[model samples]
Target: MRAVLNKIRPKEKEEVASDLKDVFDNFSEDDTINKAKEKLEKFIAKWSDKYLKLSNCFNEVIVEYYFTYIKFSCNIRRMIYTTNSIENLNKKIRKATKNKQSFEKSSRLLDFLFVIIKDFELANTDEISSTCFLFLGGLRHNYRHGPLQEQQS
Candidate 1:
């Protein structure tokens, strides 16, 4: 939304921002999945006649990804779409591997990555929930260390 607002002229930015808030009033984060699409459709229709581009963009990109968080339980909604931490971890992996050039074999790469990523995981485990730690696919936690809850099969 900040990106959208940045495109507006400063003189009218606030007014346009308020108008865009109507999009949220129509279908905010707290909405349930069943009603989300309907409200989104209504918001699109409300603007389609007046602002074709805005509505089209909203429908095509924004509304299309709208169900992303609504599909998850609200407890984990904030964690669903974020990539900053993942990107940071990726940066670390890249930095660690950059000087190595190449691994001798596939297993060598896996072993090297396991150590680096495991270090990153341990570094992050305390900063975030163990449940969200599940984000690190296949980086399983030992039960003795305390899982927020048991992993489901």
Candidate 2:
């Protein structure tokens, strides 16, 4: 695994470093700028090597072993490194579920979450598709299209 990671390490470092540089260059300097630059440089230095390893592992296991072997490629995102979007979504869901102390079952919780997600998705489907793949995963899993699964009297 390490050998595999080492192979693609340089490309990954370059990509991450370039991306960090772009983001860092956007901010203007005060004390915050220096702090952000320092943090970002350190992060790029540390994770760039590891990110390739992680990606390679995923490629090897999920893509090669599972997807290729099975001949089915899923649309799952490789990295979910960013979290602010989900924190905000959870805040919204928490507000909605504040009144309910206990969910009767996991499915009930899922149903509630689905409603919240579907309503949000109706407004900004594109942004939701791009930024929040996991949210899309949950939505896809929970979605019931066509006629209702259960017949109504």
Candidate 3:
């Protein structure tokens, strides 16, 4: 996928990426799979002729299972849908392992990776803890006891 994306000129790449984002954003807004499908069809109709390969790739590979994320809670949906953290982790792992030629055993490689990941977790613990506290506080005060809910009631 990255290779295919890289093949596009920079300006066209941005446009294509934005168009793809719109498709996912539409799916995210839908409350039901039927609505999502409808939105997806409309998106496909708009883009399919212009970007046949991308439309075909999504229809063939993604349309089958992407809607399942809608069933999860907002936090879970965010975690599942966004790849930034996972991609960052992958980049770190690649950098850490790039110098090494080989490991005697897969277990040894995993052990090394575990230590690296543990160190990273420790390094970020403070930031993560503060974010968690802020997230919980927001949930309590904003959603549970905010003015919007009062007005709705």
Candidate 4:
């Protein structure tokens, strides 16, 4: 997929110009450009009322139409928005479980998180604190000793 996109992208500008030239040349009836412009204007005017009516009709029925057809539409944004939050949460949980595969019980997981919250509370005690210290402390808490260290100590 990526290779195909890159392959086509190299020729995009030339391809677009070629398509535009074809479209422009297709409407020409005479050697004069003004005749082409005149024909384009007449053609646009002939369809303008139908276009306007369709636009208004869609606006009036949008809610009903959307409910009827939105499920069939493949909207990336809607799919991402609905799934990303839960996906991110699952990713965090997966990382947590990967780091500590020995957590055989839910209570142990809760206990580990409780210790982390407590450690952060303790680390935030002093008024003169550095962000680096907090970040390092949190990293160590999550990845290094964890609650097991405190239990052993």
**Which one wins on TM-score?**
1
TM-score for predicted model 1 compared with the true structure: 0.58
Note the residue pairs that clash in candidate 1. Answer: none
Query: How big is the positional error of residue 123 in model 2, measured in Å on the Cα after superposition?
Result: 2.8
**How would you encode candidate 3's per-residue C-alpha lDDT over 1-153 as one tens digit per residue?**
463365456767876667556555633444666666776777667656756665555563567577677776544565556666556656777899999999876646655665555455466663222223232224322222322222232
Error of 4 at 116 (Å): 9.2
Candidate 4 ranges beyond 4 A from true positions = 1-81, 112-153
Q: Estimate, for each residue in 40-61, the C-alpha lDDT of model 2 and write its tens digit.
A: 4564466656554443333323
TM-scores of the models, in the order given:
0.58, 0.37, 0.48, 0.22
Write down the worst ten-residue block by lDDT for model 2: 69-78
After best superposition, candidate 2 residue 105: deviation in angstroms?
2.5
lDDT of each: 0.61, 0.48, 0.57, 0.40
Which pairs clash inside model 4?
none
Cα error, residue 108 of model 3, in Å, equals: 5.6
What lDDT tens digits, residue by residue, belong to model 1 across residues 12-76? 67776776665444234567755666665665565456455655455456665755666766655
Runs with alpha carbons beyond 4 Å of true place in candidate 3: 1-19, 26-30, 47-55, 99-111, 122-153
lDDT of 4 by residue, 25-83 (tens): 42222323344345434533543453433223223244243233223323222332244
Error at 128, model 4, angstroms: 31
